[model samples]
Every structure is written in C-alpha cells, then in structure tokens.
Target chain A: MTETHWAYAERMDAAGLRDLMLAYGQDVWNLAFILTRSRDLADDVSQDVFLKAYRTIGTFRGGSSIRTWLLAIARNTSLNAKRTAFMRRTILMGRVADSRSSPSAEQEALARRVSDEIWMQVLAIPYKLRETLILQAKYEMSIREIAELLGISEGTVKSRLARARRRMMDAREEVEQDA
Target chain B: MPDREPEWYRRLRGNPLQEPGFTEEQMDRIERLAGERSGASRRRTESRNVRRSSGMEREGGERSEMGRSRNETNGPAANETESATGDRVGESHGYGESRRGKWSGGMEPVAGSGDKVRTGAGDGRTGRRPRRIRLRAAAAIALASVLLALGVWRFGSGGADPAAPGPSATQTVPGGGTATTPVQTPTPQSRLGEPIAVLQLKGMLAEQLPFSAEDVTGFEIYAARSTQALTVPKERTYVLLQNLYNLDLKAAGMTGVGPDHYLGSSESATLRIQTKTKSYTLDYDLATNTYGAFGGTVFRFYADDQVWLLMQGLLNAGSIWAEYDRLSEQSRIEAETRSNADEPVSKAYSPERLQVAGSDYNGWEKQFLPLSSGIRINDSYMGTSSLIQQLGNDEPEVLRVGNAIVFATDANKTSDGVGVGLTRDEVIRKLGEPNVKTNTRWDYRIGDYLKFHLLFEDDKVRFMTLTMPF
Candidate 1:
C-alpha cells in the first residue's frame, strides 16, 4: 500500500478503528503469538498494540502499511512482555514448553494436525530465527520490511531466515525417520 | 542461485494453524479500554487547565502582596520581603514549567491573604489602621529576627536544617503582615580539579565539565570476554566521554569494601575513564541494572533509562565505529546479492519448486490445476480474467468484477469438494467461517496462501472464486 493510505489510521474514527481491528486483528494476534509463543501473552500484547496505536496514531506519519505498522508494534510489545520479570521467571521455570506440549487449546489443535507439524518445528527454532521465518513465510513480509521492523540489518534477516529453514528441514527429516 | 524453501513450508499458509477465536466481546473490551484511556487523558488535560488558571490568579496576588509589603514595612523587612518574592519568581522561571506551576499553586493562599491586607490598608478610615500597621510592623520585625537567628544557627552547625523551608515549602506569615522572612539559599560545593575519590562523586557526575582533548589522557574498553583492555583513539574517546558527560547518574550507595562488593561474576563491559592524574574504572552489570565506579572507593550509581541504554550500546559493541563499518559493509554485500536474484513474490502464493524428501501430495497438482498455477481470490481482476481466458474459456461475464463462476453449473469442483450454489450451512460445514467475512462477502483460505472469496446473495453462495486444497 502507498504511504498515503496509512494516513487513514491517523484520522480513523471509532468505526474506522473497528474495521481496522476486524481486518488486521488476526494478523496482529498471530504475530504476537509467534513472537511470545504464549496465547495469554499474545492476547495482552495484541490489546496493548491497539491501545498504543490508538494513543499514538497521530504520530503514524504513514511510513508503512497499517498492518505492517501494527505487526511491528506487536513484535516490540511481545518482546517487551517476554523480557518482563514475570515472563522471565516463567521461562526459567520451564513452564513455557514447546508448542506441541503447550496447554493452550490452539496449540493442542496445532499438535494434533499432522500437516501443521511444520509450525511446531517453526516454534522450536531459536527466537530470532523463528521470528524472521514467520514474518517471511507466514506474514509474507519482505526481507527489507523485516529488517526495519526488527531493527536489524537485512543481511542478518536473510541469514536468520536461511538458518531457520535449514533447522526446520532437519527437524522434519528427523520426524520422518522416527516414523 | 539462491536456496528454495521446501514444499512443506506451504502448510504455513494453509489454515492448519488455528488462531484464537476473536469474538465481538473482545472487540467491545478493546473499545472500552480505549474509552477509559481517553477519559483519563481528558481529565489530565482539564487538571492542567485548572492549575494554569489558578497560577495566573496567584501571580496577580503576588504582585498585590509585593505592593502591600512595600507600603506597610518601608524598612529592611520590606526589602527582605521583596528579595524573597524576587527569589521565588526567579526560581519559578529557572526551574521547569511544572515546577513553576507548583510554585504558583503553593503560594496562592498566602498571596490571597496579602491581597486582603492591602485592601484593608486602602480603607479611608486611617485612625485604627495606624495601630494595626504598627502591630504588623512589630510582628514582621520579630519574625525577621527569628529567621536571622535560624540562618545563623544553620550556618554555625555546618548543616542544613531538616525542617527549613525548601523551594516547595508554602510559608504563611502570621497576622495580616505581607513581609517575608529572609531565606538563605544553600550553595553546592565545587568539585573542579579534585581527585575522583576526594571530590563529591555524585556531584561531579551531575556537573557538566568543560572537557577538552587534553583532559583525557587515555580511554580504554574491556570487553566482557577480553582480559586486557583496548585503548580507544582520542577522537572516539571524546565521543564516548561526551555521552558519559551527558548521563544523569544518581548515586545509589557506597559498595562494601571487599571483592564481595562486586555484584556479579561477570560484567557486561568496563570502561576506564583516564585523566592526566588518575584513572577511574566503571564496571557495568546490565543484568543487575547497576554500575560500580572504582576511584579509591567503590561507589554504585544508576543511570536513567536513555543513558543506561547508551552506555550498554557503547560497551556491548566494544568498538562502535568498527561495528558500524562492519554492518554497513555486510548490508552492501547483501543488497548486491539480493539485486542479482529474482524479486521474491509472496511466498504464500509462490509455487513450491523443491519437494521435501519422503513427503507426498496425492495427485494434488492434477486436482487443482488453475490454483496450482497461482490464480486465487483477491488476485488482480485483469490477471485472473487473462488466466481464465488463456485456459480457452470465453465466458462473457468473467470480465465483470463481482460475477461469480458457479461451480455447480461450471465444469470444476474444488479439491475440498466446495462448489457454488452450496448453501451457507453446507459451505460452513466444509470450510468453517471465512478468515475475513462481511454480510455479502466471505474470504476463506484455499491453502496457506491462496484465498477463496464467495459472494453471497439471499444467504447462499451466488459466486465463488478459487479452489481449496485437499
């Protein structure tokens, strides 16, 4: 979308905002879930992303598509939530296991779908690679867009995507061999 | 040639991954939260406005108070009151706007009484006013004497009185007297040209020094993994010092006088701030959000958020200039390599060329020929029409944007067995709710990548585009 199109977010009224939430809510929630790997955290982060957007919409400046902008906010909010003392403690206590063993209903459904095992593997990879892979493969973000959103160099994004795919492929091979 | 992603990756675009169900209830909650935030923001703005208007009233009162004191005291007391008012006004201007507002708010009642006293003095009846004025003058003199004594006591004790009126204190004079007791503003000690340890460490950090290249003899960085420190160039040292100088460091406390004072086993990095006479080492522990300085004694200090990040970035990089140069070079090479490759389409819709070993699609390609060739919902009208035309179909209504190709009437059924003329319930039984839905239109994912848009009329599928994957 053109930069001018994003200005709609700045002037968006309640109805416009509702339409926005309807259109991109899933994308925002999905990105948040991928980054945090916790449904509860994703819900909180998604709410926070919209709240922040509402408060700072005047500063949007039409720099990116509203979806990309919301996703970027979701990414930052998720990372920040993960960095909190509470989340860190949870992570340290090993309560936040891989997606297959995660207790969330969505995760359970994910684990049951043999075709969806690729997602479980995506989640198993390191955070940086997993995030880069999801943004590229799932969200269809360009390398340049991912780099800007993550505040990293394009070279780093490319390298992480490559590494993430290789790791997923290896994990798939292992699963097949076991079967 | 660049590496191709495996075919199984296409599952990501398929609706295999289930997002948590977002309901109207959740949207209502979001709206409610936003409303509460808006209300709070409005209240804050109104509070500021009220404070501002009250501040203006106080300023008017202060002026009247000054005039009354000048008329009533007409002596050293008057001069002292004028000086005190002047100092308060100076403080209001010197400090920030919020503090200025605070000063005005605090002085309002005192200034209001002064206005009343001035009005009393302005009365035409001069007989009783003389005695009242004399009584007020005597009280002002007595109050001034007490203040002078207190100042002397404080000075002799070599410490500030804990109960002394500070900048934020609201002082009220007894009776109707507008004269203010003299207040002695404390002078902060200078730490110029002193040894880092001997000087007031906290004050020195807070002070802005007139730094020159000659002041810093050496600047060294000790990386977390490195045992020895690397001496930074003078130019870079200046930049680093500038950042350090700008830091607002709050004195946390004095560390214990042993190796145990060091909080962590490893530091993020250490900086040696070298001057001509002495070298002060600052050890930063990012994990603990604390830094220790060793300048004859260990002192812990905390930097504000921005300064802390600045310090972390500089130390983490070990060499900021080198890191920047390396990243720039790497970016340039990556940009060149990317330019050589074909522009990547959305990976969701892009045809997968590389198959993963031992993975099989059971005649998936034959079942969905048009979709396999990338024709899907939301594809450009021109592109979809051209593709359909190329397939040798001369359906006249195909060029119309909203015209639906009825699968029940047409030659093809989707791999998922979904066809046009299917009831809304039947379609839902097959595909579930659309990812995006409106009253008239519903969009469902064909796989992970392609979408199947169904146009509805009278609660039934009138037109549908794209075939779902098996």
Candidate 2:
C-alpha cells in the first residue's frame, strides 16, 4: 500500500504539518462551516482541528484516511464550539428570528446565487441529515465512510440520504412552483 | 448496487460550496502554537535531565529558602508565580499524558493539572519541610481526584466537552478553560437561515436543444418502476418537449423501421405530453433508441444518434431514473401492496414489454464506456485530455502512452463506480480478475494480446484501458 499522510502524523515536523494543512485546509474549513454555519467559528474550528491533529498525531492509529480523521476532528470541534453557552444562546436567538418569515439580508444575498441557494438548502436541513448529505455529496465519501465518521449504521446513512434528497426535491418543487 | 449521482448532485459536486480561507494571521498563529509546543517539550526534556543530574544537591537549601519566602510574602506576586508555573506544568503534563494514551476529559485535565501542580509547587516552596513533602503526596492524590471529578462533571453536565468520543485526539480546547458564558463571548448567529430550494437545469442539455424553452407547462417521464414529474424550469421545459415535437415522423426521408428493428425487450421509459386539448404518450426503448407514439397506428421512428443521446441525458438527469431495475423491484412490491389496499393500479407501471430482438451489445460498444461520463477507447489523446480536464483535476494514471489515457479515481471527488476510483475488490467483482495479475497491473487478454488492462496504485484502479478488436 502507498504510504498515506497519516504515516507521518506521529513525527510530523512543522513543514510536514504545513503541507498537511495546505492539502486539507479548505476541506476542513468547509466541513466546519457546514456544521457550525458560522464562518468565524469555522475558522476557529479549523485552527483547533489542525493544532489538535498535530498535538495528538501520535494517537492516530491509521484506521481511516487522514482526511477522514481530520474531518472527524473538525466535526467534533464544531459541535463542541456550538455547545458553548454563548453559541447556544446565539443559535436559539437565530432560530427565533428565523421563525419570522422575513428573510435576513444574508439569506437574500445567498438566494441571488443559484449555487449559494443550493448550499443554503443543504444547510437548512436538520443537522444530522445535512451533515450526512454534505459528506456524501461534497466529500464523495462512501456510505460506509460516512457511517463510520458519524458513528451511525450503514442503513441509517442510506435512509438519511433518501430523506435528504426527498426534502431537497420537495424544496426545489416549491421554488419552481413559486416561480 | 450504487446508482449514478443525479444531475443536481453532480452540479453540487462540480460547484463546491464556498469556504472562507484562513487569514495569514491565523496561519501564523497555528504555526507559532506548534513551535511553542515543540519548544515547551524540549524545555521539559532538558529540565528533567538537569534535575536528574543534580539529584538533591540544592533541594534542602531551596526548600528552607522557599518556606521563608512564602512566610514573608503571600501576595499577588506569589499568586502570579503560582498560576504561571501551574499553567506551564499543566500544559507539559497534558502533552506527556496524551502520548501515554491517558489524555481524556477534554482540555479540563490540563487546567485541572495546572491547578494541582500550582497547589503542589506552592506547598513545596512555601510550606514547612515536612508539610512540603506531605503536600506533594496530597497533590498527587488530588491530581487523580480532579481528573476523575472532571470526567464525571463532563459526562454529567452534558456541556461543552471538546473530548467527545471520536477518532482519538487531544480533546482539550487550546487555552484550557470552562465553556465561556454568552456575556463573555458574543458569538453571532448562524448566517444560513431556513433552507431555500432552487431549481437548476442539467447543463449542456438545455443548450443543445434548438427550441425556445418557453410555454412548456409540465414534463413527466414514465420509468420502469414509477413515474416522475420532472421539475423543469419554466424557461427549460420547452427545451425538453421540443425534442419530442421535432421528431416528426412525416418529415422528409423519415423512414418507418420495422417493429423488430425499433422494438426491443430492453428497459425503456415513456414521455407523456399534455396540452390544453389533447394528451400524447411516446414510448422509447432505452437500448435501441427506438421511439413510437400510438395514434391511429403505431408510428415507430428510429431517433438519430444525437437525438437518442439527448433523450438519454434527459432521463439520466432525473432522479430515480438511473436505478430503473432496482426501483422497479421496489415499486413492484409497493404496487402489490397498493392493489391489496384497493388503491388505483393505473399508477402502477412497468417498462412496455416488447418482442425480444438481437443483442444490442454492438450498439453499446459503439458508445463510450459507461464507467466514465464520456470516454471511449480509440478516442484521440487530445480529446480524452480535454474530457479529463473537464471531469476535474484528477490526474489519470498514464501507462504505456498512447491514444488512451487512464484517469485515477479520487475517493473524495469521484462517484463510486467501476471507473478510475473503484477499489480492487469492486473492479474484481465487476470485471473478474485479469488474465495476468502483477503487483500494480492487471491485464485481460482478448484473443491473444492484452485488450483490456487496469493499472493500480494503493489498491485502487488508477488507469483502465479497454480496446475493442476490429
């Protein structure tokens, strides 16, 4: 087997770690953004993920790809960041505001771009389903890989995908009908 | 069996969601943190060596002096020294324990360790000699107690414990502290609001059709399993319908092919057209590209290669159309259940059963390999290069340079198939082991020479070559 990036995880120097960051920085940040739904939080989570990865590189057992491993870190970090009381209150407030039909300025801006609108739809799903969909679609992770990453069963992954797709189609139908 | 991704999914994959890039300052901060950590560890190692070499030479004198100083000053300066030393020792011990696989309870342990270390160092330097030694032992006991307490509190509170169960790593948040309250950290609300669905047409198909894609009301396709109402945009529905309208059987040179020529027993779907006054249904065989509409009599016309491809593209763009057979089985069961429930069986449908004809493998062979989006053996090197570039940045594994180029599959990017990204087992299961199998190359001999081969790296099919004999 070809040596994966994890081969150097245990003893990676600064330059080696920098290379890893450059390779997966965008991916890690993107996943963080998807989970947190906040760019600033994503930035923090990305930094923490890389630092955590570097600090604890020795603990990695090479069971999964380095990308998968880093993504898992990003996921956990984002979730933890969200669980902070400050984030919880902000999210609660945001949800309250969202309950109103008035779209936020950011939402209007996002709707202006078809691609951004697609991303918004993806983010609008419940966290679990949204995460599973992004992992499958954006990351092209196999059902098995997603299941492993999310600590869910393969059947759950498939079902979530079905539900997410159905929701997306329904949303698209609504938009088309409105148009 | 994995089905091909739908058109929307492919679009999403092609257009990656935007992610905010790391600022230069952020990069520098992380690098600095890494440097500090390495530096700290190196200092820790040196300190340990120094202590080992010196043994207890100055231990007694330092202890007496520490006690006198502690008695003389128990002020902010002492507190400062205590907290600073606590922080350093805590960080060092956290790193050391993480290496031993004992780091847990998130970053709390580091903080807790700092607290204990501070207490121990405080007592050792300030307390009477006997008390100092006793306090050291108590500090050790307290360290374990704090770790246990933190673990219990973490699980009990269900709070922001960064060390959630996942792939192993240091769970501690950098700059260890309890979850900050909202007042201290004013985080902004998530910008992404409620999900808004947007319609996106399949690329290239809308552009290819020579029709004003307006005035089309609705479009639906009848697949083997169930019918799907395609959500074609208002401006694009005509693009699809115009293709059907343009297939005029009465046009010049339009020849009627025999039922045997057009009709086949392969899978097919029907397109239903609805107008204000009338409705028409056209049946098209997927394998043969033969389509017919029954009016007074069956008008079977063979669609040209271009028209057939456009039709395929339309069908492929729809969700659930690609996995026709699988969904057919599922719907068959559902249909049986609905029949029992006295639901309308009219909605239940299957591919129109037609007379079996000669094999269509030749027609399939004339097309590109189904693995990739569009790649065929004997395609010009430049053409393949352009296609690969369009596919993505995945560099194909080139072996024995020729007209053919093998594209490597990226698990993170490419959809799973018997294509470049397929694992060894997947390729073997799809197309059995080759005639000649080496470490990195699998060659299948057709007749005499190797007609089909796959080059592997890291146990995944990197390059695939399939050449048809003349």
- Tens-digit per-residue lDDT, B390-452, candidate 1: 121343212111112222233344445455567788877765665434455454432232234
RMSD of each: 30.3, 28.4
lDDT by residue (tens digit), candidate 1, A21-61: 88888788777666666555555566656656666677687
Q: What tens digits encode model 2's per-residue C-alpha lDDT throughout B271-375?
A: 543332222345555554555433323444444332333344444533112222122122222221221123111111111110002112122232333333321
Candidate 2's displacement at residue B309, Å, is: 58
Report the CA-based lDDT of candidate 1 relative to the real structure.
Answer: 0.41
Error of 2 at B45 (Å): 19
> What is the C-alpha DockQ of each candidate?
0.06, 0.08
Candidate 1 to truth, TM: 0.34
Query: Looking at model 2 chain B, which ten-residue stretch has the lowest summed lDDT?
Result: B133-142
For residue B69, give model 1's deviation from the true position in Å.
Answer: 53
Model 1, B145: alpha-carbon shift in Å?
Answer: 79
Give the lDDT of residue B76 in candidate 2: 18
TM-score of chain A of each: 0.82, 0.84
